[model samples]
Target chain A: MITDFTPWQSLGGGALIGLAAVLLMALHGRILGATGILGGVLRFADMDDWRLKAALLVGMAMGPLVLLALTGQTPAVEIPISTLAIVLGGVVVGVGVSYGGGCTSGHGVCGNARFSRRSLVATVTFMVTAFATVYLTRHVMGV
Target chain B: MKLVSALLIAVIFGIGIALSGMMNPAKVLNFFDLAQIGAGTWDPSLAFVMGGALAITIPGYWLVFRRAAPLQAPRFQLPDTKVIDRRLILGSATFGIGWGIAGFCPGGALPALGTGEPEAFLFVAALIGGLLLARALETRGLRSKPAI
Candidate 1:
């Protein structure tokens, strides 16, 4: 119930994400999917590919550092859920992304942008489930 | 060049995630909580984030895909399969449950790791564990198809 409607920041941040995805596609001919990249690193299908994926993760880790350097403050992050919930949710997400072939970044952003039918289906499927899960947990069970 | 560019792109992506307030699980949960919409407390920031990204990417993809190849790679690596298999739906549904539970999607969680929070690391570690477990199942001929 307590959520900030940050339209400007959300839009700006989204544009940056779009720019990153576009650059990845334009420069490297690869989709800028976060989970896929991480999965590649874990899979280690090829040494060269592994290195590229690792570098992207490193960049992800460096994001807060860069923000700190520019603004002298680390971005605030809040995790309201319990440890048990976090781990449980994390595992589910991992398996789901693995089985589903993509996550929010891949299917929701880049795939949708490319007008891929599969991506659209994947996106809708996840969104519907997410909505249902939230409804059940917060309203039905109140957990 | 590819590694450097990939890193830069990730940084941009991470910053965007952080700036969009997606790093905050509470905010994400609020967005997922559709019941709040009628009460007038639903946060629509996530939608704006998607909208803003699409605003740029829709045209960007249209222009970029027109070329024969990318700047570095020999061919554009895209999803080849068009099949809407049961695995896709089931897997996505599973992920949706998790997303709703914690409000931490993979992309959002990455930037959150910078917060130096144990919760973030724990979630990521569990996520990796889940990935490995799924891969193990795939190896055993249980789950089919490679993730994108």
Candidate 2:
């Protein structure tokens, strides 16, 4: 059985997200768009520009680590996928970030909040594709 | 520095994920897989994540927009068009398919991958493929219609 979902936890998460977005805007004068950050890193002209990208990526990686440290709960399941598949997944997401002009964080969070038509379209596209893929993979492919 | 700010934001975002239980991929997968399992209860963690995000963003946007000159750029760059055409529907469908299969969206996937989940990586790969295909099509479309 799946563990119970907690409202407090959800609210806490939302608050953190909102705060992060706000802080990014207030301090950096930028939206918290993950895709843009990654893209900038990949296409950066100056090596110094990569600093921000690295910082952002590192923070993302560290967030859960910190939580795990506090809670001491082990990850529930291990995906039995290969390393190649993992790399391929990253590449695919990178391409999507480029094609959509943003990732879920950019479009789904910042863009959607700002009422950006492009972001809305992109977010919708992302969600729909995700849903379909899940259905096919789990239901039809049974993988 | 911008790097510092980026790191700060990422950490805060991570904290939010931890608070909301989104860090648990199993829970996320269960939400998508609702079969064989009992009628799942609402995971309010998502709501908190959304609410918390909005709480900060709503006022934050107001402040940024109010500024005469944005720190990074000349003016706020907002999208010009709002048409819900074929691109919107098609892209959305594709994205949904991916999400449903993998039980992870890009935003969620990033954090999950950060946790060193192998499956998350695979999902990310497929996501990139879809993205690339979309981009190529978009570029082609742009070329076909110079006015756009």
- Which predicted model would earn the best TM-score? 1
Output the worst ten-in-a-row residue range by lDDT, candidate 2 chain A.
A74-83
For candidate 1, write residues A1-143 as lDDT tens digits.
39679999899989999999999999999888878987988866699889988998889878877888888886567777788999999999999999999899999999999898888998999999998998999999988
Model 1 chain A worst lDDT run, 10 consecutive residues: A73-82
**Global lDDT of each candidate:** 0.88, 0.60
Clashing pairs for predicted structure model 1, backbone only: none
For B44-133, candidate 2 gives per-residue lDDT tens digits of 345456656767676778777787765654455444556665544444444444444344555666566667766765665665555555
lDDT of 1 at A67: 82
Per-model TM against the reference: 0.97, 0.74
Residue A141, candidate 1: Cα error in Å is 1.0
